[model samples]
Target chain A: MIVAEQKPLDEIRDLIADAGKVLVVGCGTCVTVCFAGGEKEAGILATSLRMASKLNGNAQDVTHLTVQRQCEWEYLDPIEEQIRQAEVVVSLGCGVGVQALAEHFPQAWVVPGLNTSFMGLPTEQGVWEERCAACGSCILGLTGGICPIARCAKQLLNGPCGGSQDGVCEVNAETPCAWQLIYDRLKAHDRLDLLMEIQPPKDWSTSRDGGPRRITREDLRLVAEQVE
Target chain B: MSAADQVPLQIVAYCCHYCAYAAADLAGVLRLRYPGEPKIVELPCTGRLDVLEVLHAFEHGADGVMVAGCLEGDCHFQVGNLNARRRVAMVKDLLNQIGLEPERIEMFNMSSAMASQFAAAAEEMTARVRTLGPNPLREESVS
Candidate 1:
């Protein structure tokens, strides 16, 4: 799931400073699971903003709304009236949701209330760590399922670097060396020979380096065209 | 009468049913006197308390809010009290951030039989809130 953290209260207050009416929008999917831009968080943020504004003597009419998924058009359509009423829209969604809102309501000024952090999963209660870099490449088959792009301090394709100390990355003592984890897992599976195979440099075209990525399904597109 | 004298400080206490709530009831049976300004809201567990609820209390005129739960490791629902304690700390930090006194909110722990402790907590919270004066929002509403 996509993980995010809310921007500081003061920063959020400043973003919607000039607006008389503000709408705080929350996404119910990825950001909800990570406890960032969920319905509950949206309400708390709205209340906090109101209190902060009141204290600053620039009281604002803050409204709170949560959609199932802000990235989709249909889900956002229901709150069109509220969005129209608000002078500024504060999106408590991930980066994609913020963009979706902006695209859907070009007339309305949309601002992000959260700093979209990473694509990851909760390791434990209240703890989330990045797992997939979404490099548009699949190399997990050769490396025991651990992602070097996301986990390793240096995205080493082959083996542990000289900076790996006692299975910990030298960049930060708290971080476990990704290559070491791959090595241990491969040894347990009796596939240590996989590490001996030298991996070539990863192709950058599939990643963000090329440009904004797009996935087009020709079959789905053709079906939609026929229906139209 | 001044504003403070005219409106008694409003304190909201969210008590867990198994322990803190029972302790308050026991205190009443024992005829122990505590501040009457606090209105008790009983909950299955303090873990059910959300940050919004505490903020709402203050937003709606609560000068102080207290969350009382089972002592550590003695929660009827295992870690409910522990989670509530962490949430209380978070709310306190938020209160401070918003320019409100952190003392306006607190968390306390007690067993079901601790009637004296419950009364003491009530007295302690009431005194703290009284010293802090009414919630600034109340002043805003009055003027």
Candidate 2:
């Protein structure tokens, strides 16, 4: 899931400094799970902005509403009236949600309330760790279900990268060396020979190097088009 | 007395049902006097405390807010107080960002048997908030 954290209150306040009416829009998907831009967070931020603005001798007309999924147009459509009413809309969503709101409502001024951090999961209570880079490819099968692209400090395909010490990355002592984890898991499964295969250099064309990626699923789209 | 002292600060205390609330009740039974300003909001456990609750208290013109729970390593639910403490810390950072003194909110740990500690926690928070004066946003919220 996409994980994000709220921007500092002061920075958020500055985003709507000129607006008389502000609306905080929350997304009910990935961000909600991470406790960043969920329904409760939207209300909290709206209240904070209200109180902060009042304390600073400004307008206090702030409100909040949450959409089922801010990345989808149908979910956002229901809140168009609310979006239209505000001079500024602060989206407590991931970067995608923020852009979706802006693109969906061309007239509404939208700003991000969260710093879109990464595609990750909560490893434990109140802790989130990055797990995927969406490199437009998948190589977990070759690396004991762990992607070196996301976990390795250097994204080395064939690695333990001399910096790996005692199964921990030298870049951040707290982080487990991805290559070490891969090696250990493979050895346990008696598939250590996979590592000796001398993998080819990763194809950069499938990742960010390929620029913004898109997929044309003709079957799904045709079904939707037919339903329309 | 100075005019600021007469501001009648309003403080909110979120007491856990298993410990702090019972201790507060015991304090009442013992006839131990504490500050009257702190309005208690009892929770099943301090672990149920959310960041928004603290923020709401401040937004509603609470001069100060406190969360009282079982002593560290002695929570009835094992780690409710610990969870509350971390949430309270986050609230402090939020308060700081909002330009309010972080001292306006605090977390206290005590067992249900500690009635005296409960009263003391109230008095401590009262004294601290009184020194800071009423929440600056109080007048703003009112008007």
Give interface RMSD, per candidate.
0.9, 1.1
> Which 10-residue span in candidate 2 chain A carries the lowest summed lDDT?
A219-228
Model 2 docking category: medium
- The digit string of per-residue lDDT tens for model 1 on B31-126 reads 999989789999999989889989988877799999999999999999999999999999988787677899999999999999999999999999
Considering chain A alone, what is the TM-score of candidate 2?
0.96
Runs of candidate 1 with Cα error greater than 4 angstroms are A222-228, B1-6, B139-143
- For residues A87-125, could you state the per-residue lDDT of candidate 2 as single tens digits? 999999999999999999999999999999999888898
Q: What is the TM-score of chain B in candidate 2?
A: 0.95
lDDT (Cα, tens digit) per residue for candidate 1, span A6-121: 99888898899999999999999999999999999999999988887777788899989899999999999999999999999999999999999999998999999999999998
Give lDDT: candidate 2, residue A36. Answer: 93
Model 2 chain B worst lDDT window (10 residues) = B134-143
TM-score against native, each model: 0.95, 0.94
